[model samples]
Target chain A: MELICPAGTPAAYREAVEAGADAVYCGFRNDTNARNFPGLNFTTEEMGTAIAHGRARGVQTFVALNTFMRAGEEEVWYRAADDAVALGADALILADMALMDYVATTYPDQRLHVSVQASAANADAVNFLVDTFAAKRLVLPRVLTVAEIAALARQVDCELEVFAFGGLCVMAEGRCSLSSYITGQSPNMNGVCSPASHVRYREEGHDMVSELGGFTINRFGADEPAGYPTLCKGRFLIAEEDAYAFEDPVSLDVMDHLEALRAAGVSALKIEGRQRGKAYVAEVVSRLRKALSAPPAERPAQLAQLRRLSEGQRTTSGAYEKKWR
Target chain B: MQLPRPLAASINCLPLPLVQRAVALVFRQVLARHPGLFDRLGPYANRRFRFDPTDLGFSFVVYPAGPDITVYRAGKAPPASATVSGPLVTLLALLEGQIDGDAVFFSRSLSVSGDMEAMLALRNGLDDCGFDLPRDLSGLAGPFAPPLQRLAEAIRARALAGMV
Candidate 1:
């Protein structure tokens, strides 16, 4: 399977390339892409450099123009598509319906991969995208079990990419509105979830309280670990119980399922974390490269080094295993 | 302690202001080499960062000064737009993108104050800068660059073995 990786910056792109990433994905430094945190992503010139850098190393570069286009703002998304093609992006991962139509008609030859944010779960939805926009690939959402993935693989004609590692959002992408409900900013529209502007951390006695838009999300003890205040991962009081009502603070590590994923007809494994650093890109990519080529029995030992870097120092296979459902 | 460890320690032990001056010089080199990358900051070009490495027992402020980064020993004057405090290694790991910056922040290994936007801008700017210390430092020595880089890598590996 191809090792598709995330690169938030030009330096990270180089690190991913050096670390043996088959492809590195990035977005422009704007809300045009998901994972659009402040100070992240690349500029036009940097994008050109990143593409050239990856090409020189025989690694493909993919640009994500994944966010939905607001009315009257279609031109911005169109321009991003034009630039991605002009800059030699190997593929464009898109989510918005309007943008998909625009790209299919305007740049028919450019490879289009359906972003996971599109939440096209079953084979029918995947087929619709492939038939409609000529999407060359589909990034499956993190909600399907391995059996389900294998089943869908038999039905869909396009290439399939599954997220192999990084932060796990509990909700179906492009469909969740919890962030919009609380902060009035949706990942679909603004490319930000629990935006930094709405985030505030306070020290209340011995515990640290994390709030989003003045609403308490989670509180950590002085010695406990905290996470980014995304609404989906917050702890809440449900039925007189105060617990992680949505999802736990852990990352997705599916290195152990590599063979099974490949067997299930996955053409690529995507690593998340465009907000991370070069060391992260290098470490994750290099180690995964080792695991991918190593003897099957040696894979677990190779992935052990990544646990410390996992969020909250813990990891989950997520919905890849049936038990998560 | 090998070739680079003692040298790195000596540099680490330099008077705080002098160390800040040297860091300022490196920052100048990074900006000069990647002006286009830094230009992505746009309006944030004038923002200042107050970095306090508490474990290292010193602090410094870095800000853009007409296409160059200006660094000085931090003082008790007006607070900067952003202030990052952490152990020296943690800060280095954060700067190198070796770990998740938010993960470190959540783990309480690092802390930030002031304008979060400016902090984000600086973090992204530095990550995009692609400033590899060992490579840049070794390049200054001309013919000795490769050997210097090896030594520096050795010291860095030993120091950062457990950070992740």
Candidate 2:
């Protein structure tokens, strides 16, 4: 399977390529894609340069113009698509149906990969996108079990890709309203979730309270590890108990099931976190590459090295194991 | 008042101006090597970032847009948009972008306050530059570069291991 990595900057793009990525995916500096943070992402000029750099090294570059286009701001998404195609991006990971139609009708031959934001998990949805937009690949949302993925793979004609490691999203992809409910901003619509502008942390007595907007997300004791202030991972007073009602604060790590994923007809394994830095990009890419090439006997030890790197120093297989259900 | 840690008490004994001069020299060397380091932070560069070495009892207020770094004796630094406090080794490893920052932060080895976005931007900016303090400082020793880097690396390793 191809090892697709994430990069938020030109420097990280270079690091990903150097660290042995098959393809590095990123986004433009604005809200054309998700992860529209303060000092992350590349300008058109930087994108062009970065793509050229990756191309020379035999590493493909995928531009993620994955955000849904606003009603009247169709021009913004169109211009981003045009620039990405013009800059020779190996593929465009798109989510908006109208934008996909525009790219398909305008550049009939450009390879398209349906972004996870499209939420195309089933065969019909996946096949429909492939038949309609000539989509070459479909990044399955992080809601599928191994058996379900294998089942879906057999039914769809397009290539299948799955997220290997990164932050876990408890809500449905491209349909998250938890952030909007708490912070008044939709991740899919506004390209930011738990926006730092709306996040605050304060010490209260013996605990550190992390808040989103004005609502308390979670509180950690003086000696406890802190998690990000996102709504899905927040602790709530549910059923007369103080508990993590939605999901625990842990990152998704599915490296141990590489064989199952490959056998399930997966073409690529994508790492999430474009908001992360080059340090993370380089370190994870190199480690994943090493694990991919290591012998079966040594695979467990190699994969286990990544545990300390996970969020809250904990990793979960998420929906893949079907344990949560 | 006694310092909280041995590292802090030892560093607190040094003359403030001498320590300030030493830190400035290292900062100058890094900026010279990576000219576009802070430029990557964009508007976040204009904000003051304070690096507090909890073990060392000293802090650094870096105004990246001004292209200036000033050392302060612990809590004496000017107001900052963000402050990241940690052991001296943890802070240095973070600057070099060699360690997994989120892992360290999540493990509670580091603590951040003030503006989250600005701090995140600065962390990304530092990661892009790949600042290696030992190797960068080794450049100042002329013919003694190799030995200096080795010694610095040894000291850093021991410090992180709490051996020194």
Candidate 3:
């Protein structure tokens, strides 16, 4: 199976390919990419150079034109798709139905992958995308259990991609409006979630309080660990007891279940942090690529080393184990 | 040394204006250290402020619309143009340059009502403030902060090791 890794910049793309990623995925610096973060993403010339670099190393490249098109702004998304195809992207990962239709009709021979943001959880949704847009693969949302993934894989004709490591999204993909509610910036619309512009932190006596948009999400004592303020993973008082109302502060580590995912017909495993530095990208991809080839029995110990690399030193199988009630 | 119940109650009921004063004092200390931030922020520092709590009679409002800082109670609507509602601790964080405005707005950790242009100006102004810890504190208290910073540095070190 292919190891699909995120590359937020040209340097990251080069790092991923050199570190043994089978394919590297990235977005243009504009709103078309889901990670429309400042100081991140690539320009058209940079993408072209990155694609050339990836091709020189026998690694494939995928461009994410994954944000939903705004009204009267479809042309921006269309030009991005055209540019990706011109730059020799191995595939185009799309979320908007209109953009998908445009690409499928305009460039029938180009490979297309349905982005997980489209929330194609079942065979019907996957089949619809495949049939309508000629999507060759579908990136499954993080809402499914391993059993559900296996069942859906059996039913769907398109190839499947699952997030194997890094950040976890607690919400059903493509259905969340939490970011837009406060920041007026939608992940689906603006290609950014919990953008850095709204975060504020202050030290009060012994506690370091973290606030997002003037609201306190979590306060850490000088001794406690503090994670970034993403609304879904924040802790809140529910019925007088403080608990993570949505999800805990943990990364997803599915390295232990790689074999099961492979057997379940997943064609590619994705690593999620494109906004991360190149060193982080290189290290994780290198480790995961090694672990995938190792015999199943010997993989756990190798995977354990990745713990020191994870956020807050905690990792979960996420929705893969049906732990969500 | 036990106090009467009435006295304890009185002590607990400090004026909301006093609380706002204390927050402003701490914010002033932070601002003092980053004078360049004020020059960069320009007109945003002059905007009015409205602070409200979810509970009644606990609003601490500050209006920077005048030459001197003005503190007022919430019921009269404090002559300010913009209103931000949250705990005092969160406000201090925003004033101290500790949090990113975009992350806060997206998470709904903070809500700003009225004066959209002023809010945007304030966010950009705050960014220029540069809320990094003083060098002395970082050097002395490096071990106590979150380990992610250390881990990131370590990864960078390891990646650069033997190469340069």
Model 2: runs farther than 4 Å from truth?
A204-206, B1-8, B154-164
lDDT of 3 by residue, A1-325 (tens): 8999988766568779988999999999789988886556777998999999999999999999999999998999999999999999999999999999999999999999999899989989999999999999999899998889999998988899999998788897788988777778878999888765666655577566767777888876654545556788777999999988988767799888887898899999999987665655777899898999999888887777665446544689988987546
lDDT score, candidate 3, position B44 = 52
Model 1 chain A worst lDDT run, 10 consecutive residues = A197-206
Q: Report how closely model 3 matches the true complex, as a DockQ value.
A: 0.03
Candidate 1's displacement at residue B75, Å, is 8.8
* Clashing pairs for predicted structure model 1, backbone only: A277-B97, A279-B97, A279-B98
What lDDT score goes with residue A177 in model 1?
Answer: 96
Task: Measure candidate 3: CA RMSD.
Answer: 11.8
DockQ: which is higher, 1 or 2? 1
Q: Which of 1 and 3 is ahead in lDDT?
A: 1
Q: Which stretches of candidate 1 lie over 4 Å from their true place?
A: B1-38, B65-77, B98-100, B134-154
lDDT per residue for candidate 1 within A78-174, as digits (tens), equals: 9999999999999999999789999999989999999999999998899999999999999999999888999999999999999998888879899
Candidate 2 pairs with clashing backbones: none
Sort the candidates on TM-score, descending order. 2, 1, 3
In TM-score terms, which candidate is top?
Answer: 2
Q: Mind listing the fnat for each candidate?
A: 0.53, 0.46, 0.00
CA-only RMSD, every prediction: 3.7, 2.8, 11.8
